[model samples]
Target: MLNSVYNKKQKPSTAGETTQSNKSWWKEGILYQIYLQSFKDTDGDGFGDLNGVVEKLDYLKSIGITMVWITPFLESPMVDNGYDVSDYKAIHPRYGTMEDFDRMIYGLHEREIKFVLDMVVNHSSDQHKWFKGASSSRDNEYYDYYHWWPAEKGEPPYRHSLFDPEGGWDYVEAVDAYYLHTFTGNQPDLNWENPKVRQEVYDIMKFWAEKGVDGFRMDAFQFVSKDTTWPEFPEGHEKDYVKWYGLRPELHGYLNEMYNKIIGKYNVFAVAEGTGSTFEDAHNLVDSDRNELQMAYHFDAVNLSQTPKGYSLLDFKGVFSKWDNAFSEKGWLAIYLSNHDNARLVSRFGNDSDDFRTVSTQLLNTFLMSMRGTPYLYYGDEIGMTNIDMPNIEEYTDIEAQGKYQSALKAGADMEEFINTLNYNSRENGRTPMQWDASENAGFTTGDPWRRVNPNYTEINVAKQKTDPNSVLSHFKRMTEVRKKNPVLVYGDYTLLLPEHEQVYAFARELDEDKILVLLNFSESESEIELVELQGLTSEKVVIDNYEGTAVEGTCITLRPYQAILFSLG
Candidate 1:
């Protein structure tokens, strides 16, 4: 019915009659996200560098990745691990020199692997030249580059800071004014309302486009546009923050200008870090006719399992299904489970215990690759990396975790409970060094690593899984190959099955004469999934399965614990 709901809307041409050709490279290719600092380290200075990524091109190709999204390697204060950019056009010495960056870029292009740079324009590190000038005097040329309110205004209306407990406004004695920072105090929010500031951001994007970068992942862009009047937000408004701060009507205007000035000219696509608060808001940002962005990367699913109680299977299914149905007609979506800002996929959404880690990781990957949108797979997920077991706040290196810890301490919250939740939900859990082998520092670095490697690396490293036929890495390779070979999986009509099933998530993707049914068991108990809606159709072949063999009689099949199976239907 959700698919039919979109039938009345204008429809675009499908992928193909038998194989895909109509879709652009971005829509057809698989995207792999590499958190630059955690990926690999060629230099022994404890930081991962550009040459480290250059060395892994062949490995990325082996996993069937066609596109790579690298987090900020641009010059930064590293206050937020490269998100607090001080210089957008220059490479950070911690990452490597400009020459090394060019080599990395050339290596990717030579392998036909598209590169997507992380664009963090919402804010700039206070150490930036523009911020320095802006804080110098009221008459400074760059004073308009950032948001500032004179201290004489009594107290500016309240705004929440994600990192600062004091609030979003920080008093700068140099100019006797307060500047806005939506994140850490060291990172000041840019004034997009100013023409000069907007031009600066556009120039930054163009600089990358000139470097042959294929695309950009705009970080925290949903909150870029502000009301500027700095009206008082009602108490408790921070609970539903995006509704108040995101998708201002003026944002579309800026996006339209950016597309005409840079994105369209460079033939590059842009995906926002998040959509606005509603389905309508999401559509307005990314619909093709809107000419703003190419895809919406929403957070509804990623935020679901952030609590100690975990998430329900039905709620998990609903979030994804709702997103898919919302984008069925016009706009597009970026599908993912885990990323640099969240805990590992297996730890958050699947069973991470040794008994089921491999199967559960494979099952989750099957869901991601089988979905309708372009899937974005995080690095280290291929080998089933789980969360780090950190008991004390001192073990954490992420600013987010440290901020939360201090906030809880100041609020008189229970430290033990907070630490327990932090262990399960901290973003640092996902930022640990990649487990390349069982060697010292997991083969990520020979010298001291910036962060401690996960202790289980000896058992779950890539070298251990690389040669195993049934390893998580192998299943990932097979699933990607299957998706690459089947157009139906990429651009198909998704129809949910077993909508009320507690443990089994089932769906069918059909394009023309080709139809594939996917079944995933989300629990440790065996699940009997009877495809009642698909009674008349029979499976022509077992397309892929996590388990060695799949047993199906008619339209019913028994799914083993954490099993994933795909069947080509006749």
Candidate 2:
């Protein structure tokens, strides 16, 4: 619990929306990602469903989240969670009926919250009807729906999967052929080269848009296009499948076509999840003039340069700085440190200890809200949710986690060391149940939860934070309100002030006469920052600081542990 007293009177409205850009609502509003199955469960089935999400629209609204991205709940075989879609248009039975989804969309509209459904176009569930037919025989009409290699060859090309040791090629004994699966064997990759396949995807998109969904968050969309030839890597770069197989020239044309067919026609928010994207890909996919996508998220900051000890902030600076300069003119980037595929932010980057948890979480929020992009907040991130270390590997339900655990044991890795890695890097860290209150199951459900709730729910639940102004949730609400009110924060020129600084992340955002300086202490100990460069500016005010009554005295301020302050300078 936050012991420091906070002033709620200084907070603005509880909605993070603005008319900052005439471009669209998607650009002007903040986005929050919710893994719906772990969000809430109303059916007492221990699983979160569409009905449960409909029940929590007000909670999202309370947190000032204007746009919500719900992860896939579409019909699936429950292999890779819901990512292995069996039906693109229908809701899963465990989730709820399609009518329930319609009601949830309507509920979101009632709150003026934009709804974005997860669109997984990279692949489909191996049990999907089309795949079923494709694997049945090459003579079937759906034979070309998936990527299948010749059975006569005995073995398909060796395609590597970062997720599994068997790689991306999975043999189908029924067809005596190999089908590509970038993920698990249960999820086979689709053949985007097929025009009919593309058309089928478009029709699915049309189904949701016609039903009044606000947007689509395409999952691993960059992998949709790849060279059809499975060429063996000329040695030494075999694991470079992600880079060589992605960002093909054909992808831009496919995106442009999709943009024109659905996104442009509906004027809907569209962002691709390009995990291995580069700045050049960013420019090609999202530059406004290209008419491809509104924006796309890359994994440079989240996956690359990370180690067991921890991630390097210096490398983080390099990644963000690269994208900032790349998208400074025409394109837009997404500002997020963690998502469904990664661990919790506080657990990954900030100190989650009791002494510094609150301030560190606030500091992370400050960076997220003040940055020049659509800030994406994970469901529980708003309340500073930390990672949970499950007692055993069996308790982890995420497919990737299970795969890694089994693979590690096979490799003779130390059990304790492997568990430590899972503790720090598992995707299941983000899929834990949302802590709504201090009650049983964190008030997410009366029945058993699909996943174990973080035991810290007693101190970190929303019920406790809603009324406490100093709570992490309260700080997020205030920061969101600030971003909504300040247009410069959304549309402004950004400059890195202390790129080489070890413990402090300092930057400035300026738009004409309106300028603001952001200073973030990224460590858990106090430090004195002497802003000699800021001395040139005499007239400035400390507009937003997590600490109460923080002052900017004579260009030198003693920043408390994890303190974040914004000074308005003209």
Candidate 3:
């Protein structure tokens, strides 16, 4: 057994700065992403609501999460699982009233946990008042709130919409104009270049901050800017749409202006969901100058897959290199393997065996938490949650999944192949209700859940794992403790070790004179390490271990399947 050290008086190196500092509270915090509809159902309405989340505050506290990023609960038509917001200020009736949202904010602050709301400013539901008004007449004052154009004689703006089966152009017969929807036709992309639109968004953000929300998770942030000319790509098989501008040069200017005008007023955290962003793009967005966002989530590591379209089996080397290069001393990365938009990490990376599944999940948690950035945990992940393999299209709640299914059929994809793709890539995997117990409806509610609960909830749930010290839940608790107790784990420089090892993943985190080594066996087989390589370190201590009975010898250490070990060095 390893003895632990608690440095109570050790002041954090980045302490005493403004709470909004990119290097302050955020650096040491752990963020929990709550897919609101699946967390808890308080009104017995069969859907999780803000009040339901408030009722479960103790559960979040017990897990030691410092920040909570709630998926959008705004008024919507449910077209995109709350991503297509119809009203930014009003909470959906199904989720609860604004009062319920306010109560949640107050409760979180009282518990010292920051509340971050999802800001889906890139697009709005076509049913939104603004979009409805814009579509009513071409010359309406609100017309500029969305992208509208006259259909060109020869070609449409772009080929079929990525999220629409009908294509990119939506003919609004009411105004005799065509609108552009980068996503679904029901979700018209917002016209960010419009000054009035910009102000409205800024004011909306300020309203939330003033109402006591601590931060905002800017969703689809890179999609806010588009090419001025709306140029079309040449006919070819190229994924890179250079002429179709994204992360435009003007993006930084707009972001800085918004930050200063709305976000700068209160000490609030801002993390951009920078999907499809290059390393250089991330650097510009998160650099310590306080000009752009405090931090940004990168998808490079998560995008590693065998398939050209979506995620695939684990490719450890590819993931490590992406993370190692994307993060820097001046900027931070939001380390996450799964979120409400993607499949669960265990299902994506593990070998599909129950025991190995648990081990692999714990391994991912340990490796991610031990790295040099703030870590975000999706709900139910700590308990080794699996993906929901819904059988039919009607069982799906995500708009993207349904749209893609239609496209697959139109593109001549066979029914079997299309079903296989949906099984692996549907957002339903992450939207499953929390598995609280083995009872009917997984004990998340007496009423039916909005989505299906994982069928394995009986064997894998909080109630069962809470009593088992060796379970994945316990491992997660221990990992959180490790992060809080070690500064090097939170603010240190990260260096990857054994880049070429196929089965073993190793890395060292160094902060001044303190160094910590984290090693993991990614496979089900035992791994052997040469003892001499680790002997050069000055001081040593075993801080954490996933394998309970394993013994570490001087020169060599043996790691059981999916085992992770953390060692301290002076």
TM-scores of the models, in the order given: 0.95, 0.93, 0.92
Q: Per-residue lDDT tens digits of candidate 1, residues 1-570?
A: 001111112223221111122366678779999988888999898888899999998999899988899999988888999999999889999999988988887788777788899999999999999999999998899998999989888989999888887789998898999999999999999999999899999988877777777788999999889878788999989888798877789899999999878876765679998898899999888877777888889999998998778898899889989988888877778899999999999999999999999999999999999999889999999999999999977888788888888889999999999999999988888899999999999999988999989999999988999899999999999999999999899888889888888899999999999989889999999988777644654444788999975666776778899999888874
- C-alpha lDDT (0 to 100) for residue 72 of candidate 1: 92
Per-residue lDDT over 196-231 for candidate 3, one digit per residue giving the tens place of the 0 to 100 score? 988999989878877776678998788688665766
Worst 10 residues of 1 by lDDT: 1-10
C-alpha RMSD by candidate, in order: 5.6, 6.2, 5.1
Q: Is candidate 2 or candidate 3 better by TM-score?
A: 2
Model 3 TM-score relative to the real fold: 0.92
**Which candidate number has the best lDDT?**
1
TM-score leader:
1
Task: Please give the CA lDDT of all the candidate structures.
Answer: 0.87, 0.80, 0.77
CA shift of 24, model 2, Å: 2.8
Candidate 2, 403-441: lDDT as tens digits = 777777777989898887787888888889999999999
